[model samples]
Target: MISLIKLSEEAFTLYRDQILAIEKASFPSPWGARAFLEEARNPVSYLWALRKGEHILGYICFWMFAGEVHLLNIAIHPQHRRQGLGTALLKKMKSFALSQAIEKIYLEVRPSNVAARRFYTKAGFQERGRRKRYYTDTGEDAIVMSLELLDRSESCAERCGAAGVTFSTSEAQKDLEVSKKRIDLPF
Candidate 1:
């Protein structure tokens, strides 16, 4: 069974090493342990690890800012690739974002990463744009993708309510049922 845990100080050294290994394997210029340590100290960012027993399968870092969550990095250990762990990590992150009142989520992935692109697409992220030569390490472009939470009001109603926004799951469901009735009833 796979489990996801928030990175803690006690796990810092191990998380750093695990993340670095996956980073080095996935990118031409991987962020080292120091960079990760810095990010881990930031209050606006969240870091998590996917683990199986004593082994870490992957890590993700995302920054929440101005009502949006920016996925800074996500890397799965080479040996763990193609196991759907990445999708699970992203789903958990999206749930986190919704719970935090984030209205949108964005990420930049290397354009050359076809597998990653397909995975993101399947996870409801739509390619919105691209940055030319965004990755200086390899002079490769980065594809920007985003998921809009506004369209997922039902999935996010709880957080919206906690934020005092007055959104409710029942209201959303009622709206959906009304819409379905409208469609079925025709003009």
Candidate 2:
């Protein structure tokens, strides 16, 4: 069974090495262990890991500030890709943003990452703009994509409540209703 857990200090301490291994395998330019530790310590940052029992499948890290949410990084284990885990993580982030009254969610992707671009487009993100030589390693430009979280008539909270959407925090694990047979895990 897969579960989603917020990255707390104790959780990070226990899974630091595994998380770093996933990061190294999933990204061409991966964040180092120190970077991950620093991010975990940042007050404005939120990180969550998708796990099956004690084994982590993936993680999403984001920064929340001033009614905006920025997706800093997300990666699935190489062996677990193409199984809809990324989409699940994105939906979880969106739900969290809506619950927190965030206005929009945005992220930067490498222009050459066609698969990621397609995925973001399908997820309702539009290309807002670009940054010149944003990546230091290869001097690659970044494509900025953004998705608005609210509509004119109703707030996301209302919509979510009406839809009977349920999400639990790190402190409340028992509140989540999970299924072992399903390939995708809930947020």
Candidate 3:
């Protein structure tokens, strides 16, 4: 069974090495321990860890500003990739965004990451623009994607068109309840 938890300072202190290990394994240009620590300390950032029992399966970090959410980083452990955990994390984020009245969520992906692009596309994120040579490590162009969250009364399927994004409204509500129990930091 997988569970999501907001990464608190105490949790980070306890799982520092494990989190860094997963990061190094998942990303070509992984954030270092210090970077992760700094992000955890940032007031604008929110970090969440997906776990199976005591084992960390993945993590996501995002920044919320001016009625928008910016996905900073998200990755599932190599062993956990291709499962539904990524989608689950995204649904959780969407639920949280709606609760906070965030209008949109956006992220940049490397053009070389075809799988990520496909995943984002299937999740109803439209590629709106690009950044030339945005990746410092590889000088690769970045694809900018955005998803607009409709009003609660509106169906996501209508706004999403044929993107085929399917998230359970009940699941999102349940996630919201779980989040209320787990999230402790002031936003």
Best by TM-score: 2
TM-score of each: 0.76, 0.81, 0.80
Cα lDDT of model 3 by residue, 1-187, tens digit:
5567767665665567888888898778989877877877898898887766567787889999889999988888888788777776787777678768898999999988898889889878999999999999999899999999874664543332222222221112322322324332122
Which residue pairs clash in candidate 2?
none
lDDT of 2 by residue, 54-161 (tens): 787889999999999999999989898888777778877887787677889999999988988998998789999999999999999999999998753555443333
Best-fitting candidate, measured by lDDT?
Answer: 2
Q: Which stretches of candidate 1 lie over 4 Å from their true place?
A: 151-187
Steric clash pairs (candidate 3)? none
Stretches of candidate 2 above 4 Å error?
151-187
lDDT value for model 3: 0.74
Q: Which ten residues in a row have the lowest lDDT in candidate 3?
A: 162-171
- Deviation in Å, model 3, residue 105 alpha carbon: 0.4
Ranking by lDDT: 2, 3, 1
